[model samples]
Target: MTCAFILGAAVWPGGRPSPTLERRSLHAAQMYHAGRVSRIMCCGGLGRNAPSEADVMVEILTGAGVPRTAILIEDRSTTTRENIAFGLERLGMSDEIVLVTDGYHAPRARAIARSLGIRCTSDSPAHKARPRTILRESGAWLKFLWQRMRGI
Candidate 1:
C-alpha cells in the first residue's frame, strides 16, 4: 500500500462494529498510530437514510480513544469505488491507502480502488463478526464480482 485509509461502512444488521467491521477499524487505528500512514480517511455514506457510515465509524474510533482531528469522513459514497474516489477527492489523502473492511471484501475493494489510479492494500477487520455474518459478507463479495463484470 502506498498510504492508508480506513474504510467505514454502515452497521451490520446486528449492530455497530459487527465484529468483523470492528476488526477493520481497530486495524486502521493501529496502522495510523504505528506510523504506517499520515492520516485516516474514513469512508462510507449513510445507508437507510440514517447517520453516515463515516460518522458512525468515527464515533467508534473516538470511543476507542482516537481523536476527532485524526479522522476524516467521506460521507457521499454508497459503494466501494465511490468510497475510494470520494475519499481521495474529499480528504485529499495520499496516493496509497490500506483498504479496511471484512476479509472477504478486501480483495475486491482493493481491486476497485486501484482501478481508479489509487495505490491501495487490504486490511480485513471482521474479528467481531460471527461465522454467519462472514458468510453473508462472502455472498456480498460474489455479488460485487458479478456487478463489476456486468459493468453495473
Candidate 2:
C-alpha cells in the first residue's frame, strides 16, 4: 500500500490547526482522492496546545471526506526527525511512502527519511515562504546537520 506522511505543523490555541497544517492535510486528502496514495499518516505531537497535531489533522482530513480507516496517527514526534522516525517506526517500512510538506521543508524531511533507510518520493503544497519562514528553515537545516554529525 502507498501512504502519504503528512508532517505536522503548529496547532493554534483552542485546538485549531495553523494554516500550514491545514494546507498539508488538505494536500494529503487531495492525494488520496487522486489515487496517489491509499493511506494518510498524520505525524505530529502536542505543541503549546490542548489537542495534538495528529488529532487536529484527523479532524481536517475527515472533514475533507477521507474515511477514518484510511488515516493513521503518530502523535509522539515534536521535530522533523522524530516525525519521520517515530511515524515510520509505527507504520513499518513495508508500504511505499510519499512525504507531504511545504516545499521549503521537503528537502530536510526527505533527507531524514533517507537516513532512516526508507526510499520515498515527495509532494508539497503550494506555499509562499515569508522571510521569517525562510530564516526558520535555515536554522532547522543547521540543527539537522549538527544532529547528523553527532549521529543523534
Scored by TM-score, the top model is: 2
For residues 95-145, could you state the per-residue lDDT of candidate 1 as single tens digits?
566777776567778877766767667776545556876787778778877
Error of 2 at 72 (Å): 0.5
Residue 150 lDDT (model 1): 92
Q: What lDDT would each prediction earn against the true structure?
A: 0.70, 0.93
Off by over 4 Å in 2: none
lDDT of 1 at 70: 74
Candidate 1 matches the true fold with a TM-score of 0.75
Q: How far in Å is the alpha carbon of 16 misplaced in model 1? A: 4.3
For model 2, state the Cα shift of residue 126 in Å: 0.8
